[model samples]
Target: MGRNVRKRRSPLAVRAIAASAALAIGGGGLVWANFYASAHEENSSPNTTKAATAQVATISCPDVGQKLTNVPNKARGEVDGELATLDQQITAAYQRLATTRDAQTRDASFVQNAILGPLKNNRSVIIDRIKLEISRVGGNAPSSLDGLSSCTGTPASQTNAGWGNNGQNNGGQNNGGTASPAPSPSASASAGGQQGGGQQTGNGGQAGNGPLAADFVDITKVQANVPRKARTRAGGSTGTFTTSCGVNANKKFNTDNVIVAPGVSNGAHHLHDYVGNQSNDAFANNDTFAAAKTTCANQGDKSTYYWPVVRIQNGTQDFDQNNDGGGKEGNVGQIQQVKQAQIKFVGSAKSQVVAMPKFLRIITGDAKTTTNGLANANAHWSCTGFENKVQLTQQYPICPRGSTVVRTFAFQSCWDGVNIDSANHRTHVAFADAQGNCGNGFKAIPQLTMRLVYGFRAPTLQNGQIKNAYAVDGFPEQLHKAATDHDDFINVFDDNLMNKMVNCINKGQRCK
Candidate 1:
C-alpha cells in the first residue's frame, strides 16, 4: 500500500534555509582544518596541499536512536517521532552541504557556521524532547544522550576506502577478512579505478554520491575464506524450513520503515523491495498485518520481508527518478528485478528453537555502517558460484561472465523472550555466537537467511571509469556503500503455520 504523504517544505525554501544556518545536517566531508589550511597556505608541498584540501564527502552524526534503549512503552511513540525528525534534520543538513559546495569553497567556515552548528542545536533540542517524553512516562532518561548531539564530517577518502573486518563475527559466518595471494600488478592496475569525488562524475554514479569503481573487486582474486565449522551439539536442531515468496515481481516498493519510524513517510530515505505481506507501510500495525494478503505460497506465512532494492546505474532512470528517496535523494538508475529470493529458517547448532512471538520485528545488518563503523555491520556480498569460497563485507564483487550477483542476510536468531520490539528496534533480538549458542536469558528462534540473486551484467572498469555500476539504495549520506546493506522482517505467520515451522526445524527435517 502507498504511504500517507506528509507535508514537506518546498525544496527551494529548504535549501535556502539550509544555506542560511537554519537546518540540521547529516552526511560527510566538511573537514574544517582542510579548508582553512588549503586556503591560507600557498607554500605547502604538493602532497600537503592535496591532503589539506580533500573534499568533505558526507556528514556523519552520532546515531542517537541506537543509544536510547530504555524508553517506557507509553513514551515510545512520541520518541520514535522525534528520532525520525532527527533523521530528517540530518537529511536537510546534508542537502545544504551538497548544494553549497561553491560557498564552502569560497568560505572556509561555511560548513561549520551554517550547517554543523545549526544541526547540533537542532539535535540537542530533539534529544531534549526525547528525554522529556520518557520522564513524563516515569522513565529515567539517560544523561549521556546530551553528548550525542554533535556531528562530524567524514572525508571523501575514508568513505571510498575498503572496510576490513572489525573482528565481529556475523552469525557464525565468515568475517570477510581472510588473506589470499595478492593480485598481479597488471591485474591490479586493470581492476583499480579512480577514487570517489565530491562533484558528480562518470566514476561516482548517482548524483556524485557513489557506487565508485574502487568499491568493486574481482571476485576471482579473493581466496576461499569460509570459517571452520563449529560442531553441533548432540541434540541440536539440524533441519530447515523454506518459504517460497516470489521476488517483488509486482514491484512492491516504498521508503517507509514501519518498525523504526512508524507513521513517518519516507523515513528510510531509500527504496525498499518488499515480498510477502502486501499491505506493509509506515502506518501498518499488528491488526493491519494480520489482515493483509501475502505473496508467499502458503497463505499462513504472512510475515513481511523487505530489503533495499538494488539498481544498475547504467544511465537509466526509474519512475522515481524525480521523486524523494530516489533520484532526488541521489538514488538513481533502473531498479533490478531479483531473479530469485530464497527464504529459509534454520534451527540453532546448540539447541532446538522456540516459536517466535507473532509480530516480532527483526532488523539485521546496519544500514548506516559506513559512518556508524563496523560494530553492527552484517553485509555479505558474493558471486553465485563463489559463495562458499568467499564472502565480501565491503566490496561489491565483479562476477565473471554468466555468473550473477548475490546478497545474503543471516538474521538474528536469539530472542530476549520478552518484548516483541525494543526502544531501538534491535535490543529484543540477538544473533547467536560464533558457536551458534544463544546467550543467557535469550531463547533460540528460527534463524532466517535470505539469499537474493540478481541477473545483471557485471559492471566493468575501463579507462578508470565504471560501465554498469550497481548498488543498494541507502540514505544519500551513506553514498551507497556496501556495508550499509540491511534487511527487515516482521513475523505474522498464522499460529498453525508458525507451529509447523518450529516443529519442522526442531525435528531436523527439511520442510517447505
Candidate 2:
C-alpha cells in the first residue's frame, strides 16, 4: 500500500536471514506456519533426522573453475538486452502479484473476519444455509456427489483436467495464445467455497515448488543418471531422458548440451549472454551437466539437490516438455516466465542442482545506450572477476550513469515435504526471496539456463498459471498477498535482526 524505493542489496545480506525471515503468501490464507515449519528445517527426533537424511545427498562439481573464452564482443549487449526484457517481464509479474495480494487480502478479510463470524454460532443451520446458497449460486453438488468419500468429493468417477502424476506435461498448449477466460462468477464462487467450506487444509499448494517438486531430479542426478550411451553424442539417437531437467537434453546441440569453459577468467556472464560467449569460444565446450555441477561445487558444499536455478527462454516455444505439475512451460507464458531458472539462492544451498542450459537474444539500445558489449557497460553483476559475473541474475545495472536501476523486492524459496492442503496434491519447494534481504547474496546464486523459444507469450499469465486452472489460477490473488506482506516486512523488518536469524539457519542452530 505504502511506497518505498527498492534497491538491490549484497549477497551476504540476503543470505543472512533468507531462511527464517522469508515469508510467502498463498490463497488458503496467509499463515507463517507453511514457510517455517518445513521438513528440511526441523530435525528434532533421531527418526526424523534419519528420514530427512535419506532425502539429502552430496555430489561434486569439480569442474567449477573450468575456463571458457572471455572475449569482449558486443554480443553481450544483445544478451543484456534480452536479460533486461526478462527483467521487465519479471518486474511485471511482481507488480501483478502485488495486485493479486491486495485482492486476496480483501477477499480473505471478507471471508475470515466478515463471512465466517455470522456462520459460527449455528453450525447445522449454517451448513444447510450455505449449501442452499451454493445451489442457488449454481455450485450445486453433482447428482453423483452423494455418498462419495470425503477425499473423492464425488460419488462416481468424474472427468476434468485432473492433476494426476503427469499433470505438469498435460497443461501444455493450454496457453494457446488466446487469453483463457477468467473463471466465471459461478466458478469463482465454487473456487472460493472450496477454499472455505471444503477441508481447506490439504497439501495442494503446499507441495514442494508447486507441481515440479516430485519430478524435480537433482542436476547432479541428471548428470549421474546419464545412460552410458546417452552420455556420448556419437549415439545421436536423441537419447531418452528420465529426469525432468533432461527434457532439454534430447539430441539437439542446443545450449542444453554445451558446457561452461574452464578457467576463472572465463569471467561469469549472464546465462542470457552465453550465446555471445559461445560465439567467441569463451563459452565452455564441456558437457552441459558437467559445467552445471562444476558451478555448483565452486559455490561451496557438495549437495546436488539444493543449488538454486536461474532460467531464461529466448522466445515462445516450450523449452521444457515435461511440466509435470509445475505450470512452467513454453517460452514465457501467461502464468510464469523463465521456466525453472528465475529461482535465486543464498548461503550453502547451491549443491541441490541438476542441469540447465543457456539462452541467446538480440537487444538494440536506445539513442544513447548502445548494445555494445563493452567491459564497462555498467551492468549489474558486471565485475572483472568470474565471481562477479555469476551474480548477474540478482543485480540490475543502471543503463545510464544518472538513471535508476529498476530494483525489485521479490524473493522465492522452497523446501521439501511441506504440503499446502489435500487437493493441492503435489510436492512443493516453496519460492521465497525479497529485495529487503538482497544484501545476503540474492544476486550471488549461479544461473544455470538461458533457453530460446519461438513465440511471444504474456509474462503475467506465466506467473499465476496454476495447473488446476479450475481451483488455483491467476496471479492477482496470491501475488498481491506476498507483495504487500513483503513490503510491510521491508518497512519494519530490522536488517541486523534478520541477519542474526539467517545466521542461525546457516549454523543449523535454528533448525535444531
Candidate 3:
C-alpha cells in the first residue's frame, strides 16, 4: 500500500483555484440573468402578452410559490426547472474543472463556467422582471371562487380564493388614468406582479439594476452536493533530513527534501494539505527507519522498512522548477512527468519489504544485486565524485542530534577514502567503496515520507516490519544513471488521520 501525499500549490496556484471557484458561482448567475432578459423581452411583445394572459387566464390557480426552497414546485416548476437545469450545468462545470488541470484541455469547463457564473448569481435581476409583471395582476382577491382563475375551465374553490383577486377595487389606487393600479409591497414580494391580466410595477429593484438577494451560494452545501469535484492541493512546507549516521559512507540520507524557505526544519518533510491552507514543513527522515530494521530483526521479524516518495500529478496547475521563468505555468502532461519520477523512486523495494503507511524503502532498476534480487548497490552511493561506497552507522543506544556520525551507523562506510570538498569536510563523512570518494550533498536528506513515520511501531504483526537496512553512497549521480521503470501504484492513507498529521505539522510536531 502507498501513502497519499497532498500536493502543495504556489501562491499563484491558490489564486487560480479561488478564481475558478468564484467563476463557478458567477456562471450560475449569468444563466438566471439571461432567462430574466428573455422573459422580460417576451412580455413586451404582443404574442407574449397574449401568452401571459393564457398562463394566468384562470383566477383559480393557487398562489403556490411561497417559501424559498432549493427545489421548484408545480405552479412555478417550469421556470424553476430552468433554474435547476442551470444548476446542473454549473455542477458539470465544476466536475470538468476537477478533472482538468490546464487551460487547453478545459474548453468545456471554461465554457460552462463562463456561461453559468453570472446567471445563478443574479437572482435579483430575475425577481425584478417578475415583479414588474406581478404588479399587473393586482394583490387582493374576491371572496367567492372565480371561473377565470382556474387553468381548467371550472371555477376555483374558496380554498384558492386568494388566486381569484381581480384587483379592480381591492388593488391600490389607480395612478391618474393609468391602465392598472400599483401593487402593495407584500403582494409585490410574494405574488410578483400578476393581477387582472395587467403588468405590475418592478419588484425589489429597478430593471437591470442592483445586486441579487441570494448572490452568495453556500460553497459548503455545494461541496456536499458534489463530493467528487473537491479539489486536492499539496502542502507548501518542505522537509529536511540531516542524519550523519555513517550510512552511505558519511553522506546525508540519500533522499531529497526541498525546503521552501521560512518553513520548519525537521528534515525531509513532505507536503500534506492543499485545499484550505497552502503551507509546508520539515520532518525527521533517517532515524526510526533503520532503527525499525534492527528492532524488528532482534525480534525475529522479516519485515523491512523504508520511506515513501511521490510525484504529485497536479492536474492543470502550472509548475516552476527552482521558481524559474518568473512563475510560468506548465501543462498537465509536463506536471505528470515530474510526479512520475517521484513515484518511481518511492515504490521500488526489496521483495520482503512491505511498505509502511508513510515510509517505504525503494530499489531502483540500476541498483546492483549480488543474487536473488537483493540490493546489490544503491543509487545513493554511486553519485560520489569517485567510485561508490555504502556503510551503515554503528548501532546507537540513542539517536544522536543533528546528522548521524557514520561511526554509530549500522552499515559500513561506502566512501572511496577521498574528500570531495575541503572547505566543509567533516570526520563523520563516509567514503564510497567503488569510487573512493565521499558522497556528495544530494544524499544528505532521507526520504521525506519515511521520515514522517520514523519511530512509529506497528500495533499488530499484520503490518510489515523492517528486516535490514542499507545506505548507498553516491545517490544523485547513481540515481539518475540507473534504469528507470514506471508503476501506476495506488497508494492511499485515511484522510481523517492524514488531517490529524497535518494538524500536528501545523502545531510543530515533526512526526507524531
Candidate 4:
C-alpha cells in the first residue's frame, strides 16, 4: 500500500515553464511571458546544479491515449463500445481516488467502496466482452486500457515550485507604469514575453490596457439592466423540469489542499477544496455523506463537490505551501477561499425522471492542460449574460461595473437510462440544447448549472509590498492557455435524497 506513498514533486523546468505566464489580471487579463526551451547539446558537460538548469521535461503518461480506428462496424458496436464505456468508468474511479487521496483524511474506505469497487466491476465486464468479440471477429483488439484517452490526474510531481520565479520578473510589469501596450487579443498570445531560463511556456497572460483583464470574468461589466439570457429550449412536445438550487455561498473550504495523482499518491502539482458534502476528501464515507448536512435548500441531499482551491494571487502567491490540520487554516498562499457554488438544474421534460446513481462523477474542463495553444484551450471564461462569448485571449475578465463576477458550470443531464455512467463520464448522458433544456429518449435529471460569483480583490499589500494574488490556487502553471481552469462534481447523494429529487423532476415541479 505504501509502495507509492512518496510525495511527488514537479520539475523546476515545468513549474518554471508554467509560472512564466504572468497572467495580466488587470485590464486585458493575461500578459503571458515566454519560456525559452533550452537547447540540449550532445557534449554538454554534467552540472551539479541540474535542478537550477535545463532538464528534460517529464510527461505523465507515456503509454496512454490510444483511440481505436478502422475497426469493423460490428466490433465498433460490440467490443469498442464496451471498451469505451469501461474506460470512462476507470477514469471516473481514478479521479475519485486521486481526489480522495488528496481529501482531508485520505479516505481509503471511499476509495475502496465508491471508486475502486465500481471500477473493477466495470473493467471486468469490459475485458470479458472484448475477448469474446475479438475472438469472434477477424481484427485485433486494443491490448490494454493504458492506451485509453484519460481525464484523470497528471503526474504533478512532473511540476516544480510553479515553473520558476520568472513570473516575478513579469510581476515587475504590475509595478511599472509603462506596462506594454495591451495587445489585441489576437496578438497577445505569440511568444508572450521570454522566460529568463531555457524553458517552454503555455498560453495565458496577455496585456490589456482596459481596466478589466482577469482570467475568470467577473460581473463588473454587468449593466444594471442587462437581461439574463433565457435558458435553451428544445420547444418539443415535452415539458421541461427545473431545479433552482440555491448557492451554498459562504461554505467553508476544508483542509483538503493538495491534489493527488492517478494512483492516489500525495501530489503537490495543484491544489483544491471540498465543501457541501461533509464526507469529501480521503475520509468520505456513505454514512458521512448521507449524514452530512447540506447547504442546498434540499435538506437530505449529500454530494461531494470539489474544485481547485481559489487563491488571492497577490504578489506571486505560492501554492498551499503549508497546512495546520483538519483541512483548516491551510492557505499557505495567503489567498481568499471561495465559499459557494450557485447551482441550477436542467432536465428533459418528456421522459420520466430517474434517481441519480450514487458515485456519478464528472469533470467539466481540463485543469492539467498546458499553456501551449489557445485553439485547444477550454479555460471557459465569460461574464454574466455574456456566457456564450468565450474569451480565449484573457485568462480572466474584468466585469463591467454593476455586474457580478460569475464562473459558470453546466453538466450533461440526459441519462442513457441503463449505465449510470460511461467511460468518458459524459457519454451516458447528453446535453439538451444550449438553453439548458433536455431532449427526448432520455430521462431528465436536474440540469446541473453552477455559477461562482466573486468580487475581485486587488493584490494584497504585505511586507510593505503589494502581493500579486490569483483568484484560485494550485492550477497547472500554464492553464492549458484555455482549459486550465475547471470544476468537478461527485454524486455522493443519499439514496432517499436522490429519489426525492428524481421524483421532483418526473412530476415536472419547480424544485429547489
Poorly placed runs, candidate 1 (over 4 Å) = 1-21, 26-54, 157-163, 166-174, 177-203
Lowest lDDT block of 10, candidate 4: 22-31
Global lDDT scores for all candidate models: 0.73, 0.19, 0.20, 0.37
Model 4 lDDT tens row, 44-81: 11100011112112122211212332344344334423
Give the per-residue lDDT of model 2 (tens digit) for 129-242.
323433554454233322111111111011111222211111120111101222232222112100111111111121111111111111111111111111212211111111
lDDT per residue (tens digit) for residues 1-512 in model 1? 32233333344543453344456743222211122112332221111101112334445677878888888888887787777766666566556555665677688777668767777887677788889999998999888898887886654444433445432544555376423322232222222111222223221454555665556778898777667555789878988999999999889999889988887777788999999999998888888899999999999999999999998876667999888788877788789999999999999989999999999999988887766665677768889898888887777888999898999988899999998899988888888887888886899999999999999999876544566788999887676867788899999998899999999999999999
Comparing 3 with 4 on lDDT, the higher-scoring candidate is 4
Which is superior by lDDT, 1 or 4? 1
Location of the lowest summed lDDT over 10 successive residues in candidate 2: 482-491
Task: Give model 4's TM-score versus the native structure.
Answer: 0.51
What's model 4's lDDT at 222?
Answer: 28
Runs of candidate 3 with Cα error greater than 4 angstroms are 1-427, 432-512
Regions more than 4 Å wrong, model 4: 1-268, 283-288, 291-297, 316-319, 322-334, 349-352, 369-380, 384-394, 433-442, 458-477, 480-482, 506-508
Q: What is the lDDT of residue 315 in candidate 2?
A: 19
Candidate number with greatest lDDT: 1
TM-scores for all candidates: the values are 0.87, 0.19, 0.15, 0.51
Q: Rank the candidates by TM-score, best first.
A: 1, 4, 2, 3
Clashing pairs in 1: 25-93, 27-58, 27-59, 28-58, 28-59, 29-56, 29-57, 29-58
User: Quick one: ranking by lDDT, best first?
Assistant: 1, 4, 3, 2
